[model samples]
Target: MSAPANAAVPQAEQSLRDTVLSRGYLRLLLLCVLLGVPIALACFFFVGLQHLLQHWVWESAPEALGYAGPPWWWPLPALVLAGLILAPIVTRVPGSGGHLPVNGLGGAPVGPKELPGTVLAALATLPLGVVLGPEAPLLAIGSGLALLAVRRSAAADAKARAVVATAGSTAAISTILGGPIAAAVLLIEGAGLGGARLVALLLPCLLASAAGALVFTGFGDWTGLETGALALGELPSAAGPDVGDFLWGLPVAALIAVLVTLGRELGRSTVGFTRRGSKAARTVACATAVGVCITAYALITGRSPAEAALSGQATLAELAADPHAWSVGALVALVACKGLAWAVSLGSLRGGPIFPAVLLGTATATAFSGLPGFGTAPALGLGIAAAASATTGLPLASAVLAALLLGGDAAEQMPLIVAASVVAFIVGQLVRRQRPEGATDTAGAAGAAR
Candidate 1:
């Protein structure tokens, strides 16, 4: 045989080995470990950056100028600045500001050109107090980063690419909300697959999510931010599923579904209206409207504008702890203002939708808790489950996220959360069916991912 032919034999055998390894579970597990580390680190950095920026903008900068709290008008210019920074990117860049959180998660993998735009836009809107979350943008960033890493390796097939992307997404969002299971449910639901195919996709997700959570916990300990997951500082004694709890859960779900659907319709309308103008012009208009809504919340409730803006992460803990802190009137003002701001975010800003939806649900449920037979815990779980279902259109995911948010009490509240989620899911489905032919879905991001 010729020398060239002899060399080809080894190369072909090597290629065959690589392909087999990539397909095997062992290789996938190995890749999960390797990819999870960097993805987890990246998530840490991304989260840390958001935290630092929020502090600087809301706390440090204000204190520097000798102000006790930011003036009431602070959100107006801050949001207007959000428009200036994000307008061009959403319009001029690719990926359309990273998949529009209102559309749900997981699309064709984002490209290199579009990835930076996602990062830039997220950085701009979130820290400045736009009513959005880090989940959607983080998904895109993690997926984009994963694809880049795999392109250099042997497992570059379509299946491999999909797995890598899924893993990256799991890692990216692992610690943002509650647990790895939440991330897994979200990716599985969003993928819209089933049977053996779903299982195949789910394996990598589980591994990656586990790794990401471990890393997030470690990082939190190292840095002392203690923010890898959501926690309720106070807990009200929860009653198990009572007849009244189940009976009233339906009405609560029905009411929240209607409100959320209305918000969705508003977002759709805003999108149409904004499309009429230039990108920058549309962003400015939407952002200014957002500012107005937030200002209204602050003015009406005598709460900080921060309560009305951002992803609602900071506010969720407090609201969960003390449902009685605000009167019914204050709670109503909060829901109205926050919902309006959330709608505006969907129409204009670039961030995730999930956190804001949960916040809205938390407020509504807490308000309803004042009625007969409903305790604070039950109301919170029901409200969260219903709002999540309405916004994300995923019953299972919404249930899981709601239960997990209860932390150590998750097991005890599982039945109630699941029931509420189911009720909300049915109501949401019925309401959606009744919409006009061209009606839009509710605006939000990852199950609290936004």
Candidate 2:
């Protein structure tokens, strides 16, 4: 009887442990859901703010002054002004105006103290026509906000706080690029998390993401503003992948890897190139260089300066909507100018590298579609994937993003996109020189490229 009673105690303890874990997970799920609403709301507001400023500064104000479009020189003073405003914030504020997105996508969590600097930097650069995306800034914002939330809540343990912070990031990024799955891929690959730890992180992320996406959808409908989701709109009918398609995709991916690596390396060099200068001087000089790049694109393509501005989201939609309308010359100009702008932005501005890369990828792929046996759809898909991989170093995530962006066309194009992603990622690794650990050279300033 004594032995049986002792065994019962062990079973009881085990049962209690299992019950506690189950309850803990459930509570976490609830926390994620609750957090999702506010993060989504915050994202909605941020998007609106960016749009409002872009319209008044880049479009409405120019129109109010009676110009049909901003002249080629329009961005010069605009960028200078942005640099002036952002210099102090990035240099003096906590978080260095947020980690440069070119360095990598989600790194350490942004503290509440650093959140303001991140927001200020993005607001200063993005609406003023810096060729960067909102993704990185939003990631920081989400992480910061989540950390703040956890600080205010009952979660005092280190593990709980980290989980909540990650959940916040996932919720914030869920709908911005495409959906929860994309967010999952980005966080998983970018963080290098796997196995049981990956599963734990992923559940809260998925839960928060689902809730956040729902909120974004509902709020977007209510507000009637585009929620900044990537949609390829329409794609040409894709033929199944053939040997010839892979052959072309291989070269295309290689080219993309080189272009991305070269651009990032150039951007990284700027950190040291301007390190000795005052923050204001560096910011002004870099912004001016970006303005020059945009002007060159306008002059070369004979398009409005606005076409080369922003994060390149609208331009990507335009390319997908009417590929025939964009001459090869125009596409080349866009890629060249945007690459230059991307480098400058990476060096000085506060934004993500994602949108510009996507646009460049689309243009490059479309331009090369005339190659024998490289159909339009496969080339376009491969280009987008390779370019994304080049920038991000996360081939799997990049492939998913590219395929999903193709919208209805993904079913037929997934194989080609996957192949391109793998090839580009491997080639990018070969072409990219690893940064020495703890060195504050340009590459460290950038993060990982994506």
Candidate 3:
């Protein structure tokens, strides 16, 4: 009787465990969908706002502000205004205005309580020609809003709230990142999560991302503009990889890795310095200096000032389509100017670093493609992966983004991108490991001395 009873108990426990797991997963999935709605809405709002701002900057702002053309100094005053607005909000608000989106890529989860200030600050800085992208703010806003919604509701459990927050954040930029898969992969790889837990987390994330994409598409259609999943035009046919291609990739990857390491350190130092300085001073000084540098570059190169500022997506696209349009020297200069601008931007602004880094890499690769045996398109793809992976410390996502951006040409370029990513990853890791024991002290000393 005792043996029989024990056997029944084990069976009953197993059934109960299965029941709980199933119920938990189901609830999480539902919560993820619910959380995803607000994030999608926020992303839609920001993207729409950006489009409106672009139109205003190009057409209305010049006339409205009494400028002869898109005033090169236009972004500066706006940036200063943004800084003033953001400073007080961040100081008084929770979550430090969503952890400065520029610095939040590999950061931990933040709650909904911090949404208002972060979203406001990001909107102020992002469209003002600050060298940052909307990706980080989108994530913060999406997740924060979702968390807030969940908190207001009485039905959400602790586990359900966590799942929703994660899903909302992941879905916010899902389409912006080419697709939801890339965003999902980024979260998974960056967080080092796996197994059944990962699957449970992913189901909701994927669902939310799908929903976000749908929302973005609907809004874009309504606005008569483009949004969601960047379209690659006229992809060149991919050829099989050769030994020479692989060999050429190694050195280029190594060079980009080194540049990324330098940029990362510079960004860290700049951010620290700015954080310690008076907010207004840092905002004005950085904006003025960057503005001057960009103006000089544009004047010197006889190119649009846009080339010297922002994330350079347009420049990158043009270069990729026709490398010969710009002189190699000009491209090289663009790389240097943009890199420095991005470093400074990271220090004093709130935005993502990925776009600028990709732009820099693409420009460099396009310039170097004049060499024998290296095709422009392939080199651009490889450099994109290498530089992105090195800077963001996400090799897999880099490889996928490069490949996806290449579209049909991904097959041939995929291997090269992967190889470059691996090398960059190793170089970046080694550089990170080799930092001096008193690096923080040294950095502080340098800042103080400055």
Which number leads on lDDT? 2
Residues 227-275 of candidate 2: C-alpha lDDT, one tens digit per residue: 6687566466555556567678779878888888788888787766657
Deviating ranges (above 4 Å) for candidate 1 = 1-23, 195-237, 433-450
For model 3, the stretches where C-alpha displacement exceeds 4 angstroms are: 1-21, 63-82, 101-104, 152-159, 194-236, 433-450
Q: All candidates' lDDT scores?
A: 0.75, 0.77, 0.67
How would the candidate models be sorted by TM-score, starting from the highest?
2, 1, 3
Please count the clashing residue pairs in each candidate, in the order shown.
9, 6, 0
lDDT of 1: 0.75
lDDT of 3: 0.67
Q: How does each model score on TM-score? A: 0.82, 0.83, 0.78
**Candidate 2: global Cα-lDDT?**
0.77
Greater TM-score among 1 and 3 belongs to: 1
Candidate 3 lDDT score at position 213: 48
Candidate 2 regions with alpha-carbon error over 4 angstroms: 1-21, 194-237, 438-450
Q: Tens-digit lDDT track for model 1 on 1-450?
A: 999999999999999888767647567778877988888888789889988999898888888988887767789988889888888888888876776655555456665567888988888778887888898888877788878887777746777677877878887877685668888887777655564465355434543553455456456556887663665574653545455665676688778877776676677677777788586798888888898998888888777888888998888888988779889998899899989989878766777777898889889888888778777777788788888878887767887888788866654455566666666666666665465664434322222221
